[model samples]
Every structure is written in structure tokens, then in C-alpha cells.
Target: MSTADVTSSTNDQKYEIAHLKLVPKRHIGRMIAAAIVLLILAAIVRAFSVGQIEWSYVRDFLFAPAILDGLKSTLIMTVAAMGLGIILGVVIAIMRVSGNPVLSSIAIGYVWIFRGAPALLQLMIWFNLALIFPTMGIPGLFEFRTVDIMTPFVAAMLGLGISQGAYTSEVVRSGLLSVDSGQYEAARAIGMTQFKMLRRIVLPQAMRVMVPPIGNEVIGMVKLTSLASVIQYSEILHNAQIIYFANTRVLELLLVACFWYLVVVTLLSIGQYYIERYFGRGSKSITASM
Candidate 1:
């Protein structure tokens, strides 16, 4: 080609400079309206004198070490329950997907019973297990044989975590299902062992799918920790109750508990966003990095 021809072609090349596009001004109006609504809510709260409580009293005894003790129990129960629930969820999820009819049926029943019953009722029943099955010593097989291995705390853990597992099992099963079947076929075609395929391929993929719902469950578990209060587990809500009972400032004391809960849930939600983003980055549909 001649130099003139090449120069003409190069001159035809185009580059588009990107500019910041603005949203409609009515969107700003909506935002201002939202701000006004929030201000109105704040005014209502103030009008009800919710924040007029003597800050000194709250600072003094409201947040004493004993109050913090309740928060500690809340954390302990939450961690323990979530840890146990995840384990149980994995087991049940696997059972749910198993080829065996009996195993799958049993897992289904387990999920049904727990999900059907109220968690609070379950907690009460567990707490009273000590009364139900007092003791049964076996011959000489073991030291205690059928030992009286029931405590209020242990019972509460079982009730909470087991119930949570039933719900989480479904979440996990959905996650596993969301993974493309072709991935499994490919894994099998490659002669990967079932265990190997599950560990090396399936679970990681399922976990990515599980992130959003599982994050919700984690936050729900944090709030569910309050249920342990029925058994006197001294969680955040329990502490708030103790303070409220002492002073009868129910709303204000409850606000303290709500604050802690809101803080924890907010942090968990932010963590969930990052986790979901991490998994989302793996999506094939996404051409651009987030």
C-alpha cells in the first residue's frame, strides 16, 4: 500500500474519551426525601425521650463487667453453635444428595422435624432432658455406660446448632445444586474419585454459591444466640434484660443490646459482601473485574 493510503487509514482510527455520566436530578430529590424521612424518625425518637436517659447512670452500672459477661456468653454460644451447625449442615447436605434412598429419607426427616418445631420449644425440651432421661448404667461395657450427659448449656447448644443445621443443610444443598452438572460430569470423565471430585471441585464451587445465604445464616445465628437467654445463657440480650429489670428503663436498656447486635450484624454483612465478591469474581459471565 502507498504511504498516503496507510496515513488515511490511521487517520480514520478513533478513540472515545469516557466522561462521568450524571444521574437525573430527581434521584437527588429522592435522596433528600429519604433524608427528611430519617430526620422525622429521629425527631419521633427524641420526642419520645428515648435518648434523654441520664448517660452517667448508663455508663456506671449499665455497662459493668457483669453486663459484659453476658456479651461474652453470647459470643461463646454464637461461635460454638455456628461451628457445630456448619459441621452438621455439611453432613446433612451430603446425606441429602446421597444416592441411597434410606439415608436421604432420614436426612429429610431430620430436617423436617427440626424445621417444623419452634426453636424455643426445642430449647426448653433440651433443658428438661435431665429430668426426662435421668440415668441408665450399662453392664460393664464402659465406666458410666448410659451416663447422665445432659446439662442446660450442652442442651442449649444441641438445640440451637442442630436446628440451625437443618436450615443450613438446605442452604448448602441449594448451593451444591447451583454448581453446574457438567462440572461433575467433567470431573467423573477425568476419572477423578468421588471423594477427590467432591473435595477438589464440587465443594469449592458450592461454597461460592453458598456465600450469600450462608452469610444471612451467620447473621441469623448471631441473633439466634438471644434464644439461649431462655436457659439463662447470659448473652447480650440477657445482659440488657438484667440491666432493664434493675432500672425498668426497658427501651433504653434494650437499645444497648440492639446497638451491639446491630454492630455485629453490620460487620458480618460487610464481611459477607467481600466474600460474595471474592466468589463473584470467579463467575464466567463477568468479563470485567469488579
Candidate 2:
């Protein structure tokens, strides 16, 4: 290009750049909203600090032996119930998607009944099951009193686990269906059996979809264990209730329970984040490349 033409282009670019003002926009409304929220939060904190609640009771009972035992029971029940739910969910999900009409129908019915009922009502039913069946055992090989066998723990676990299975089955089925049709066709083309395809190819892929909801369910299960308090299951809330009943410090005991619940849920949330990231690595890589 000629020197005159190059010089003219450079001069024009400089003129355009000079006229481009980079003014920052002011968020007046957002600033006002944030200020208002802070004020409300400060008021709440002040009120709680000045309230009649005996904070010492909360501190004292936070690590009490009874509370610790209750916390242990809560954790155990959560793990056991989730394990049962996951196993039942996998089987039910498989049955739901199977070609056999009878199996599919049974799975559908199971989900309908369990998921439709209130969890509290289900717990009540299980706790009181002995009224309907005074004796429960194998026909002749064994016989045991239903009341003796159906403790509060057993009733709570069965109610929570079975109800959780219904919800989890739907989550699993959705995860399985999220796999591409081509994946199934490709597996069959390679002479892979259905179960083998699922175990080796489908389930691994589906884990990415399944992990989130299942993690949420785990958190929900932790809170749901509190419902067992109604059945005299010695979970955290139940023990907290017992303490308050004796000491007449209801709010303080409740605060202690709340504190522990928040701690447990927070820890579980961090674990869920890492697990989701692990399962989502492939998707994240593909996204980054794009």
C-alpha cells in the first residue's frame, strides 16, 4: 500500500478509538436492594442475640452423651436406608424398563403406592404393623411375634428405605433413558448382552446423570431421619426432644439439633460437589474443547 493510504487508515483508527468512551454503568437499584437485605439480616441477628433462649443449654447439650448417641443412630440409619434404597432402586429401574410386561407393571405399581403415600403415614403404618399381623415368620420353619421383631428402628428403616426406593427408581430410569439410542444399538451390533451392555457401557455413562439427584436424595434422607422421632427412633431430633422435655429448654435444644444438622449437611454437600465433578469430567472436557 502507498504510504499516504496507510497513514490515512492509521489516523482514522485513532479518531475512532478516541471517540469510544468506556463509561461504567451504575446499578443504583441493586445497591439499594443489597443494603436493605443487610439491614434486615442485622436486625435478625440482634433479635436472636437478645432473645430469652439459654445459649448455655445449647452449648452444654451439643456434645452430651445422649445427643452423641442419637447422632450416631441418625448416621447409621441414613447409611443403611440409602443403601437399601439404592439397591431396590436399581432393581426397580431395570424392571421398569424391561420388556416383560409383568415386571414393568409390578415396578410401576410399587412406585405408585410408595411415592403416593405420605412418608409419615408410611412410618406410622410400619410401626403399627404388628396390629394387623400379630405373628410374622416363615410358615413352619420359624415363628416370631411381630411386635418383638418390629422395633422402632426396623420400622423407620423399612418405611424410609422403601419410600426412597420409589423416588430413586424414577431418577435411575431417567438416567438410563438419557443414554443415546445409538449406544444400545451399537452394543447389540457388537454382540453384547443387555446386562453386559448396561454394566460395562450404559451405567458408566448414566452415572454422570444419576449422581446429582442421588446426592440430593442423600441430603434429603439425612433430614428425613428426623421423622423417625415420631416413632421413638433415637435420631438427633428425638434425643433433643427428650432433653428439652426433661430440662424445659425447648428452643435451646432445638438450636443444638439445628447446628449439628447444618454441619452434617454441609459436609455432605462438599462431598457431593467433588463426586459430581468426578463424574462430569468427560462432559466438562468436551465443553472446554468447544
Top candidate (lDDT): 2
How accurate locally, in lDDT, is each candidate?
Answer: 0.81, 0.93
Model 2 segments more than 4 A misplaced? 1-21, 285-290
- In model 1, the runs with Cα more than 4 Å from the true position are 1-39, 48-52, 61-63, 136-139, 142-149, 284-287
lDDT of 1 by residue, 1-290 (tens): 99999888877664332455876556877899999999999999787675577656555655678667776787788888888888999899899899999989999999999989998999888877656556545646543312245555676788999999999899889988988999999999999999999998898889888888888888998889898888877787887888788888777777677767888888888989888877776686554654
Worst lDDT run of 10 residues, candidate 2, spans 281-290
Residue 206 error, candidate 1, Å: 0.8
Per-residue accuracy of model 2 over 119-213 as CA lDDT, tens digit each: 99999999999999999988979999999989999999999999999999999999999999999999999999988999978998898999999
**Model 2 residue pairs with clashes:** none
Native-referenced Cα lDDT, model 2: 0.93
Candidate 1, run of 10 with poorest lDDT: 141-150
CA displacement after TM-score superposition, residue 207 of candidate 1 (Å): 1.0
